[model samples]
Target chain A: MSDVVIAGVGMHPWGKWGRNFVEYGVAAARAALADAGIAWRDVQLVSGADTMRNGYPGYVSGATFAQALGWTGARVASSYAACASGATALEVARAEILAGRCEVALVVGADTTPKGFLAPNAGDRPDDPDWLRFRLLGATNPTYFALYARRRMALYGATETDFAMVRAKNGRHGLENPNARYRKAFSVDEVLASAMVADPLRLLEICATSDGGAAVVLTSAEWAAKRGTEKPVAVRAISTVTPAFPQTVIEMPNFSTDSGVAVPDAVTPFKSAIAAAAYEEAGIGPEDLSLAEVYDLSSALELDWYEDIGLCKAGEAEQLLHDGDTAIGGRIPVNPSGGLACFGEAVPAQALAQVCEVAWQLRGQAGARQVEGAAVGITANQGLFGHGSAVLLSV
Target chain B: MADGATRERVPAVEGWFSIGDAPALIGNRCTSCGTVFFPKASNFCRNPDCNGEVFADAELSRTGTVWSYTDAQYQPPPPYIPRGDPYQPFAIAAVELEAEQMVVLGQVADGFGIADLHVGSRVELVVETLYSDDERDYLVYRWKPLS
Candidate 1:
């Protein structure tokens, strides 16, 4: 596919909007449209990350935002990939633009999460795996992140200090991001002193459920030239890939993992597997990446991404961090926008927000927290329950 | 079921499990490419390559090692918990059973908090009752250190 340029990007500073999701979505969409220098009627397609709307059809969300944006008669679609929802929406929009389906496509993701621990939908139904996991087993979300954190500490000699440093590093950058939810820098002591939610994980180490929104506008490279004649930041590839077969070791919101009983499971662990797919499609390897925006749901998970995304050798992420490689102004800086740790979990909007950060850094437009001379960048996130997404962008 | 409140041990849906300690968990295996799915898939196979009837009954390992473990700090809302008040925390873990060469996640015993777990720790699986309310009951499985 030809390159799709992200002509315009926008966000309604991620914090509790306490408003309907569609409204935040519309506001972000209009902001993106304005940034693209395009009128509302100029866009031809729209896509959105699906939200859990009570009394909705299939949980689809695109048309809702379309209607809120005044029903411009744009071809619309909705996508859901757990935490990776925003990137999935971006993928669909990029596909349409590259396939010659539409020149200007708007991608938006927004959500206002309900208070309390995220649980599965209602119904006595054992038939639905999401509900069954929660119904049969009271496995909450943080427990999953804690599981991975524990695995890393064991396999990689990762220390609580390593995890704390992640928070410290990201918190420092987050303090600079006006769009970030948590702007105050955190101390290693603060992280350790926080209440323990899951073993080895304190409340400070985990991301909170948040209400926020982000949006971006995509158009063909040809369209980009026609509009402004300068080199626009192009979306080189989008990878909304899924997990390999026999998904063993229960994921979040599940009682247990796939039994791996039917056959030999695909060997690559889930996150790295997704990165491999993205790299293959984008025609670049880890060495090619100037920086990355990874799904940092937890501090340990960020280090895990260093391996999964090939930022470093397996089990070497902690040392890489210690070497000051991933920190801003260091080699291959990561999560310069502070990630979910600083931004808070906005569900669907989180991934798209990552893409926005990449676009800014690639164009050398990011103000205080720019990755110096960053060019080629990638954003990797996996939405739980079989929805995977990744994107590679270049200037 | 000892509690007067936990939901009945009614399987939310049918065909997810067979009755026994050696209870071979059943799931849909793709007939075309021989791919196995857990939590059972009666629908299509998720294999990136082959397209075929994804149906099969597969047995999972009954025992495994602790890949990792954590505990709930806040109370989980229903359908995870039937009743809500004075949120009591619980332990959860991911177990790596050598036989299946995969990891399984579940709750650890009620009191096993984060301070009590480490990676590569040995654990065993056991079917345990979750909530037992008046009309129906709920039964789930958990993993604890083999010690």
Candidate 2:
């Protein structure tokens, strides 16, 4: 495949803006265009990550963003892969550019969440697994987080204090990130003292839903070369994988696991398989990573991602944190952009926001949060409803 | 001989569990390969190695150890109907069936709290009324401490 490069990236700071998603998307799109020094009309394709939470317009995000950008008559595509929406959107733009179908593509994902735990869209569709989970088990998103948090504590000896450490580290970084929603630094005491959202996971250990937007401009490396764009970070690989059969772990939207009797049972866990696919595609192991941005929907999940991403051996993530290996200046910094703890999930926007952070760090543009001499970076996120996506970028 | 007519006990989700004294979860087992599934997979076995397309109805283990548990302090949004009035928090548990070698999620039986359970505590499945309306009592499976 030909090299596809990110020309620019932009985001509307994550928070409860109470504004329409269209406004957030448009603002980010404009910022990306300006950063790339390219005109909106110059784009040949517009790809958007659809947000299902907000009504009708959110469903047709491509047309919504295209019309907002003055209808340049660009080829538009909208993708929805739950939380992986943004990374999947990036995949769409990359495919178009690599196919030589478009010289320039703009990808955007944005959302404005209402206050409180996210619920299934108002409906009585028992056929939908998401609705079924809530109606049947009352398994809210945090409920699943609690399950994993408790499991990690039981299996790995991870303490509530270890979970608190992750929050403190991410919260400290969030203060340096201008676009972070929660800029206040969190201490271990504060995190532990916060009322328990679920047993084993305090309120501060879990991520909240909030409004945000992220956008990226993609073009062929040749196009960037012609435009004199210097040191552009290029997409080396994008892995969007599904669970292998006999998926052992209990993921969202499933009440029970596939029985192990039929097959020999997978030696590889599902989440590890997600990152492994990316490494294989990029032809680089975890050792090559200068930094990584992983989905930290909850603090415990971040440690799971550490092992899943091969940052350490299985069940060794807590020790990695205690050793400060994942800190900003540590061996391989993870979530330098503050992750979901600092930037509450915008679902559609969060994955690409991860990429925007990687891009900025790779280009040495990330100010106080910059990883010294950062080069190769990767971002991983798992979306509900069977979407596992990871993207590898290098300058 | 009657207390103001009669109300039917309904399965909240049909075909998931048994209705009698030897109550067990109803699941499907691949006859050829012996792979078992809960919530009864009406389709093919999920195992990639299994070519077995035929499934037989099987009764899952009635007792299992608690794999993990949590409490919903906040009222879960709708489709999950609350009993009434001031919302009460409820404990939920994930139990690992030894025979099936899989974990199943269910609400804790009425009157059980997080304090009553531990990671390896043995529990048995029982059908209980989840919520009731004027005409019917909606029944679903709950995990109770093995007495």
Tens-digit lDDT string for candidate 1 (A136-254):
65666777788888778887789888999998899988888888989989898988888887777888888887777789999898888888924478787788777776676467666
Runs in model 2 deviating more than 4 A are B5-7, B31-33, B43-45, B48-54
Off by over 4 Å in 1: A54-60, A229-231, A259-262, B1-60, B82-86, B110-117, B134-138
For residue A294, what is the lDDT in candidate 1? 90
lDDT of 2 at A211: 94
- lDDT by residue (tens digit), candidate 2, A1-395: 43899999999988998999999999999988888888998999999999998887889898899998898889999999999999888999999988889989999999989888888888798777688778877788898888888888888899999999999999988889988999989889999999987788888888999899999999999999999886688898999998887776777877877666656557788888888998998898999999999999999999999999999997999999999999999999999999999999999999989999999999999999999999999999999977999999998
**Compared with the true structure, what per-residue lDDT tens digits does model 1 show for residues B54-130?**
46667666667777777777666677764435677778777776655567667776546556666777766565556
Question: DockQ of each model against the real complex?
Answer: 0.50, 0.69
TM-score of each prediction: 0.89, 0.96
Error of 2 at B54 (Å): 4.5
DockQ-based class of model 2: medium
